[model samples]
Target: MEANKFLDAKGLACPMPIVKTRKAMNDLLSGQILEIHATDKGAKNDLTAWAKSGGHELVKHEEENGILKFWIIKG
Candidate 1:
């Protein structure tokens, strides 16, 4: 899991977090991971749904201190 870029949208809200993640994923190469740090309450569900719909994978996610650390592999 090598991440070429990291997007910290920790204080962002709702769709922005997923939007930012999608934009970053579009710019990433296949097999490259995108590390996302966000606090959006919807991230867990949004990211999961996006990953499924886009045919990508969410490798892992951890939430602590009201922040979510997402490790995603671009499809």
Candidate 2:
């Protein structure tokens, strides 16, 4: 899906991906989408929970070639 901003967190681990995602989301307006590319396997669950807790929408997510992609709409 289309996104307003893209955050590449590839090669990072754990909290780093979520941390970067949080920072990147700050640059977007409400309802805008932030696309994140992370190699951390834990990012899927971390981001999903983070988005839900922050009231943002986790639009979709998938994995390919060990890369995890997520689309989050700013709340």
Candidate 3:
């Protein structure tokens, strides 16, 4: 199953994007995928750290057209 979630926090910074993602992920089932779109450069480390601490999985990360994208799976 390729369940996908989208989180758009283009203007938010630091922990905000990751915070919003954590909130959204509370409703997700295990193994569900989340695709986050953020403009903050910190999103890269923030999302990765959160995923590691929370026992989730980070599948991919990239920057395209200035948007920081992340692919994560719920724990």
Candidate 4:
């Protein structure tokens, strides 16, 4: 999936990835995508929940080489 913006949250833990993601998403318009790369294992659940609660769309997600990649569309 393509993204209008990218956030490198690799190596960040806990709330940091979500924190940065929230900030990045703030700059996007509705329907635009934000791609995030994170190494935190908890980010999968964290981001999924956050996106849903925030009314954003969790478009796609996958893992590769211990890295978690998420594609979220702003709602």
Top-TM-score candidate index: 4
Q: Best to worst by TM-score, what's the order?
A: 4, 2, 1, 3
Q: What lDDT does candidate 1 reach at residue 26?
A: 88
Q: Each model's TM-score, in the order given? A: 0.91, 0.97, 0.91, 0.98
lDDT (Cα, tens digit) per residue for candidate 4, span 1-75: 878999999999898999999999999999999999999999999999999999999989999999999999999
Please report how far candidate 1 places residue 7 from its true position, in Å.
0.5
Over 1-75, each residue of candidate 1 has an lDDT whose tens digit, in order, gives 457889999889887998888898989988788999998788998998999899888999888898888898888
Question: Least accurate stretch of 10 residues (summed lDDT) in model 4?
Answer: 1-10
**Which 10 successive residues of model 1 have the least lDDT summed?**
1-10
Pairwise TM-score winner, candidates 1 and 2: 2
Q: Can you give the lDDT of residue 69 in candidate 1?
A: 88
Q: What is the alpha-carbon lDDT for the whole of candidate 2?
A: 0.93
lDDT of 4 at 72: 98
Q: Which regions of candidate 4 deviate over 4 angstroms?
A: none
lDDT (Cα, tens digit) per residue for candidate 2, span 4-51: 999999999887898889899889999999999999888888899999
Runs of candidate 3 with Cα error greater than 4 angstroms are 1-3
**Residue pairs clashing, model 3:** none
In model 1, what lDDT does residue 35 have?
93
Candidate 2 TM-score, true structure as reference:
0.97
